[model samples]
Target: MTQLSSNQFIRNLTIQDIDDCIILESKGFPPEQRCSPENCRYRLSVASNICLGLFETTPLGDSKLIGHILATKIATERITEAGMGKRIQGVENSGHFENSRNIGIHSVVIDPEYRGVHLGHIFLTKYIEYIRQLKLADKILIINKESLIPFYSKVGFENLGLTDCRFAGLIDYDMVYNL
Candidate 1:
């Protein structure tokens, strides 16, 4: 695995960065987990937070986009009065987000050649930090299966409980991180 120099910087993702992100996702994830181009663009366009491209200046006209991470708003209604997270404090139902105060980590992908460079950590730190700064959402959540729990745990997420996130009978964990 190759390592990048320490001077690299992560910048806000833009529409132009979608292709690179798609390529990285295709390489880093299995087909079942990969998002389609339309979905990716919609997500990138609407996310409250997006961190893409760890890069440095070049002699050429622009910097290169090296990595990407995208987080979208997660909206859930308080269906159960006894539920632990029933009352979401600061969330708004802006139509884009369906219900309460939460953000969903949709995707995190790094260029395959740059995996060992800690770019993933750098990208995640930037995303989480931005939300922290804004004080926007009370919690962050993700839906993933058992096999990816270890990786998500390393980044401060915990298994809050199980969710009915089934795709053709496959189940997923409801992971959360309190911000």
Candidate 2:
């Protein structure tokens, strides 16, 4: 794990992390909203370096993944020209991960037991830092619930109003953070 503190750290997701990530995904979102295991595996195979997990170190030298944020890179032009509405589909379906200038945050989840501790914020901050360090993308985008607009805004994402694509029967808003 990439140490963030004495007891906490963030690191890239690995093949071994898929099961844990799926569990967290199930707990965090409904079935229709969660990415399938195949998709998660595909993401890891393609861009494992960008898929991050936040963990707390145990006294016994073990660690638990308490939160995670996964992303896929997409061409900035596609988003700017085609618009986010047209590309809200699955990243694996888009075939845009190869060479891109923007990152789409597919999911972000924190363990229920770990909420309210700003762990989500901490994970996101560190994720952004990692992105910058790697020069990964020119910007980051996310389609999130309206309730999360302010939260994302606080993280430097600008609201782009409602999105055209609907997933899991919930209305979502598009937000972007330019690097």
Among residues 3 or more apart in sequence or in different chains, the pairs in candidate 2 whose N, CA or C atoms overlap within 3 Å are none
Q: Model 2 lDDT vs. the true structure?
A: 0.77
RMSD of 2: 4.4
Task: Give the C-alpha miss distance for residue 108 in model 1, angstroms.
Answer: 1.2
Error of 1 at 142 (Å): 1.0
TM-score, predicted candidate 1 vs. hidden true structure: 0.73
For each candidate, give its TM-score against the true structure. 0.73, 0.86
Off by over 4 Å in 1: 1-4, 51-53, 56-62, 77-95, 98-100, 167-169
**Model 2 C-alpha lDDT per residue in residues 1-179, reported as the tens digit of each score:** 22356888888998789999999899888898897787777666677888999888999999998899877776652232123212345543363455777888888999898888777876887788889888988888888998999889887889988876576667888888888
Highest lDDT: give the candidate number: 2
